[model samples]
Target: MHPFKMLSEYGPLLLEGAWLTIQLSGLALLIGALLAMPMSVARCSPRAWLSVPVRIYISFFRGTPMLAQLFLVYFGAGQFRHELQAVDLWWLFRDPFYCALLTFVLNTTAYQAELLRGGILGVPRGEVEAARAYGMSAWLRYRLIVMPHAYRIAFPALGNEVILLLKGSAIASVVTLFDLMGQTRAIFAKSFDFSIYLWAALLYLLITMVIVRIWRYLEKRINPHLQRRVIQAPKAVKTAVTATE
Candidate 1:
């Protein structure tokens, strides 16, 4: 079959796979971010008990390869099938999609928590002191001041994390999840067409470009102060230039 004809025939399948990829990555990033909030705070705690466990978790996830983590959840769950079945929770682990999702959430949560911890620490002490001076409760301060500023500081890194997670989601194909890469591989097996891989690459690049644009827009919206302000020439100078022209 002609390459374009092959693409035309399988384009919808590729799109469906791309959509699945987006869903997987988007959910992981959302859940990871939510879980990261408390973990980040715990990571910042002065108490050893509070910080140590979070430190260990972050270290383990960050230190390990994501593929290993995915395998542990997807394949390792079988090792405890009887125990899981006894607990009536085997259904969740038995599905490859859920196993992949669980692994992604765990991995992204660790990285996001560390990023947020850095952001929280970067919050200016004087700003925090001023909030304290205003008689704000700890929770209130976190809600009103600290978290917002921290998110602003960490927004770029968080965007990078999401992009990384999106790319990493391709590994889900290893577990039999029909993500974009999985579909590409399937099509390649039948068609023996190398161009299918190129199409997959283009789709990945297009998705990434969309994500980058959206992230940049959100970053600007959230941190308007960081955007450079446009300055206009003085009215007199403009008039003089206009007259000269």
Candidate 2:
């Protein structure tokens, strides 16, 4: 079959898959970011009681493969179906989409927490001292000084994390979620067409390109002071003498 005809037939399915991919990735990133904020603050706490548990959580997720995590949530939940059903939470665990979303949220939360912790630690000590010298309360200091700076420092890495999660969401296909990779596999199964995979690859690349461009734009907007300023040499003034006496 000609490529155009193939695309015309499969385009809608691919679009649907792409939308599902975006939904899964976007929600996971947003929720993970929200959860990460407080977790990160706790992770950086001086008290072991506050920090150790968070450290362990981050280690487990970051140390293990995301695919393994997804499998654990999806398949492992079945082992305790009765327990989950007893609590009326089985409906959430049994659905592959929710299971996948939960796994992504858990996994990304660990990474994002670490990123934020690093950002928080990266804040300049002098600036923090200055804030304290101004008699700012801890909450006021964090609000006016620490968090804004930490987020700015972490912004680029956070964007990269989002891209990684978007690509990694392909793993959701294993649980029968019908994301982009899953749809591509289904199309290939029906037509045995090699070109379908190429189309999927292009679609993935297109999505990635869009994300990168948007990230760059937002990064520039947030870090305007970091933007490069072009310095132009002053033009030499030309004094023309009509007639030299």
Candidate 3:
């Protein structure tokens, strides 16, 4: 069948795949954000031990390709099944979907931590100093002042990461998860039509566009300071100002 006709024929199946795509991406972002919060604080802590391991973890995960990580969890983890079973964590790691979710969570946590770390560091020292002068404790000072400012500064970049990871949930296909990409591939295997694959492509594009729209809306709402740079037109000359005064 021609690509366009095949697209119409398979529209419902592709929509199913797209729905799954949104599900996986949404889960990853929510879970990833939750995981990153503490990791960010740990990296910024004064303690070398706390920061060093986090730095290494971020370096290792972000530095490596996500596909490799998925493989490590899915195939490689089986190599350690006996050890994991001893700790009663094997069931969680053994399932392919669990492994994929775990990989997405871990990967996003590393990236989000750095975004947060940059945000925290960018918080004005004066705000913290003032908070201290007011007799607020260490935790209170950071909570009341530093975290808010730091997060606002780097939000655009973090928004980008959130969108990217959401789209990247398609890669869970490689680990045998029936995510959007995987389901599309499965359908194409039976139909033997290149156009089935094209429908899959369209499904991905549709979800991606929706994600872009959502991020644009959210980034606008979250970062008011970014609006400060809109250059205003110069006011009408003061030729009439004397009459007004």
Candidate 4:
């Protein structure tokens, strides 16, 4: 069967599923980015007490499989029905959507936090020193010098993590989110044809290609200096280098 015909039959349903996937991913990423910044900052602090828990958090999340973590938080945590009910926070845990969102947020935040921390630490010391010498306050130093460079370094790494999260959304199906992968799985079960899986794979590949293009565009915009085809050094600088040699 041709791919177009297959899509024509189930295109609407798949589109709806893909839309949900996009929605879920967007919200999860927004929430994850917000949560990750402070956690990254905490991890970089000199105080062992502050950094220790962050270390454990990133270690725990990154160490475990996301699906296992989801299962533990959803089914495992739900078992504490009485305690959770007493606290009135059970509503959040009870809803599969919330649980899935929470799981994605926490998992991705831990990952992004580590990346951000690495990016921050990777900032050039000389640039930071120059900023400080220019009467830039600590906050200003971070805001102007550190943040830009850190983000420049973290941008590609963070983009990869986002793509990983996009793919990971498929795991939400097991929890009943009925996102793209989940809906496709249901369709596949009903039809008993592998074509659904193939279609789903194509859809995922298309989405990933979009993300790749976006990352490439961002990489160019964020570092205009880096986009040069060739850089010509000035005669004075070249002469100084030759004299030093």
- C-alpha root-mean-square deviation, each candidate: 3.1, 4.9, 3.8, 4.4
State the displacement of the C-alpha of residue 225, model 4, in Å, after optimal TM-score superposition: 1.1
Give per-residue CA lDDT, model 4, range 110-142, as digits (tens).
Answer: 999999999999998899889988999988887
Q: Per-prediction TM-score, please? A: 0.94, 0.94, 0.86, 0.89
Model-by-model lDDT, in order?
Answer: 0.95, 0.94, 0.81, 0.89
Candidate 1 vs candidate 3, lDDT winner: 1
Q: Candidate 2: lDDT over CA atoms?
A: 0.94
Q: In model 4, which range of ten residues has the least summed lDDT?
A: 223-232
Against the true structure, whose lDDT is highest? 1
Write the candidate numbers in order of decreasing TM-score.
1, 2, 4, 3
Single out the weakest 10-residue window by summed lDDT for candidate 1: 1-10
State how far residue 33 of model 2 sits from its true place (Å). Answer: 0.5
lDDT of 1 by residue, 213-241 (tens): 99999999999999999879999998998
Clashing pairs in 4: none
The lDDT of model 3 is 0.81
Candidate 2 vs 4: which has more TM-score: 2
Q: By the TM-score metric, which is better: model 1 or model 4? A: 1
Q: Write the per-residue lDDT of candidate 2 for residues 1-245, one digit (tens) a residue.
A: 79999999999999999999999999999999999988999999999999999999999999999999999999999999999999999999989999999999999999999999999999999999999999999889888999889999999999889999999999999999999999999999999999999999999999999999999999899899998987654454222222332
